[model samples]
Target: MILTFFDQFAIPHLLGFPLIIPAMLIPLTFFPTTNRLAQNRLSTLISYTSKTITKQLMLPLSQKAHKWTNPLFSLMLMLTMLNLFGLLPYTFTPTTQLSINMALALPMWLMTVLTGLRTQTTTSLGHMLPEGTPTPLIPMLIVIETISLFIRPLALGVRLTANLTAGHLLIQLISTATLTLFPMSYTLTALLGTVLILLTLLEIAVAMIQAYVFVLLLSLYLQENI
Candidate 1:
């Protein structure tokens, strides 16, 4: 009954209710709540892991950067949860969309750039041209650097989109092939099923890694500004 191959990527509606409501909310269900006196091992593990990652990210930043830890940690947790949840069968991944990725990237990138412009105005502008630049190349260098600066958010979004899209496409292709080949060749179908399972596991790792990479790059961007 699927109308198109890309239906899996489509924003789904069920019973005239936007499935996106649950698609988005499911990630929140896994988050560790604050009101509990004692948490399960899974929650404790998530807390410890998040704290460890936050510390590593903030290590190179200044003492004043502590203010950013909360937001960055929260964003990382949200992204990680969204990604891991997407691996579930019949689920949609919002981070797979360029618009969502860009939406997440743009504001943080802008805030960092703005912070640089505000607190470290001279230093921020100076990032455009390096020291000991030949006078002849100064104009060209500034133009190149400026372009690179604006491209940061675009890069962030494209990276996340391309990676997730490629993985999902491959998964679809392999799964379809396995199903199609099942009747004619049991051996081939079984082989492909194994491959599909392996790919799914790999995709899970990729989902986590991509989320971390997104936040890690953002933190690096903040490092330049902070």
Candidate 2:
């Protein structure tokens, strides 16, 4: 019975077709194409908002990293849309999956490492150990720093997955309680329902914040490499 709630997170398939691909693609439909001017109010707003976000994200980055603006902007938009859509009834969250989060994190992390290695080999290797280290502590510090460096992608994936999973589970549990109590007590049910509404609103903010954070961290990593 406990597994029922988690089953919602599993990728659905039918007759050998994976549904997750379609789900991921659904967000693309909402975006306006660059072929036309965004004359409509909604389209204009979307354009302005996207540009503002891109600018903010690129502010701390060096000139070399500015080339990543388009890719990073699209990633943030996709992540934001997927997270918001997941809040709707009967929808699934792709970011809630560790594999999906890791897929997103690993390549970006590797790119940063590779860029650093290619452009600034000495600086990149220098990060593994501090200068003027005591002789006895040099080996231990290198091991610790190396472990931390390798753990970056794992940390990224786990942070996103754990936050979304915890929020969704709370929502499900509270919603179940509200429904189960309705017949016995209208007053308590109404109160719980109110709390659920507030929690849902909070989750919406969380969804957006988490998406921003994911991209912001990537930008920081890029900054270090460049």
Candidate 3:
């Protein structure tokens, strides 16, 4: 019975074709095309909003890191859309998959680290040990720092996956309870229904917040490198 609840997270297949592809594509439909000048308020708003966000995100980085603004902005938008899209009825969340999250996280994290190494090798390696550590603690500190460095990507992926999964599960459980009690007690059902609505709203906020947080952390990582 518990496993049944988790079944919702699994990728669906129809006639051996993965449904995730369509799910991923659905969010793109909401975006305004850049083929020409925006003729509507919606497109204009999207353009302005995107530019503002990109500028704000890049504000903390060095001039050299400005090259990453477009990619980071794109990542934030994609993740935000994917997360919000999942909240709709009968839609799937691609980011909820550990493999998907890791796939996104690992490369981005590695890029920042590699950029640091390539641009400032000594500084990057120096991060592994403090400037004035005692001789005995140097080896242990380097080992600990190395492990922590490697764990950053894993932490990013897991944080996103766990929060989304937990929120979805709670929504499912509450919805099931509300439906099951509908005939038994109208009052209780109404109360639970109200809670369910509020929870759904909160989950929506969580979805956006998590996406922002993911991009924000990546920006911080980039700042260290550049």
Candidate 4:
């Protein structure tokens, strides 16, 4: 099926609200703390679903949040799935849209900030502040930090949106230019189409790069605070 921003949310919402946001574990509900010990016991006792639910029901929300390690990884996977599958001719790339990127980035920014606060490293907030200066620098740093913090998500959202949107549009524009010059020039069309095909491959690589950038920065932010 063709991918669109609405399709991303609509399909999941139709199924279950829980599916909209990424889950830490895929088949296994909560992450196993000790490893295969619980998995081995659970497997021998009853069905996997039964085991998963029982394990999940027993845990508190705080505990569950602590176990979540790969949130940015999950977001990257979702975005990758949307872009790769939708790259087929007429399908839309939701990654190319600001709305979708904002949705992804906004939550990430909030999570980053909240994580910093919870981890009790408020001094790490000084990254947005200046290095060394006089008393007058305090006001300047406050304004600068405020701007910097807001820009984090905005920059993240726009970078991917603009790159993907521009790349795809460029390919389309090139093909359209050729068509205008020689409407029936099968040779020119074939050559340009090959270029577009190559670009599509490049776009797949870019998808991975985008994911790495997002996740790496996320990890870096956590490391700084922790």
Which one wins on lDDT?
Answer: 3
**What is each predicted model's overall lDDT from 0 to 1?**
0.86, 0.89, 0.91, 0.61
Better model by lDDT: candidate 1 vs candidate 2: 2
lDDT per residue as tens, model 2, 33-81 = 7666546777778778888888899999989999988878778878888
lDDT of prediction 1: 0.86
Candidate 1 ranges beyond 4 A from true positions: 1-3, 15-17, 37-40
Residues 1-226 of candidate 1: C-alpha lDDT, one tens digit per residue: 3445667777788888878668878888765467652657776876788788888878878887778998988887788778877778888888887888899999999999999999999999999999999999999999999999999999999998888888988888899999999999999999999999999999988888888888888888888887
**lDDT tens digits, residue span 140-164, model 4:** 8888878887788888888877777
Please list the residue runs of candidate 4 whose C-alpha ends up more than 4 Å from where it truly belongs after superposition: 1-68, 128-131, 178-187
Worst 10 residues of 4 by lDDT: 19-28
The digit string of per-residue lDDT tens for model 3 on 35-99 reads 65558777788778878878888888889989998899889889898998999998889989999
Root-mean-square deviation of every model? 2.1, 1.5, 1.4, 10.2
- Per-model TM values vs. the true structure: 0.92, 0.94, 0.95, 0.63
**Best to worst by lDDT, what's the order?**
3, 2, 1, 4
Global CA lDDT computed for model 2: 0.89
Query: Model 1: how far is 129 from its true place, Å?
Result: 0.8
Give stretches of model 2 more than 4 Å off.
Answer: 34-37
- CA lDDT for candidate 4: 0.61
Index of the highest-TM-score prediction: 3
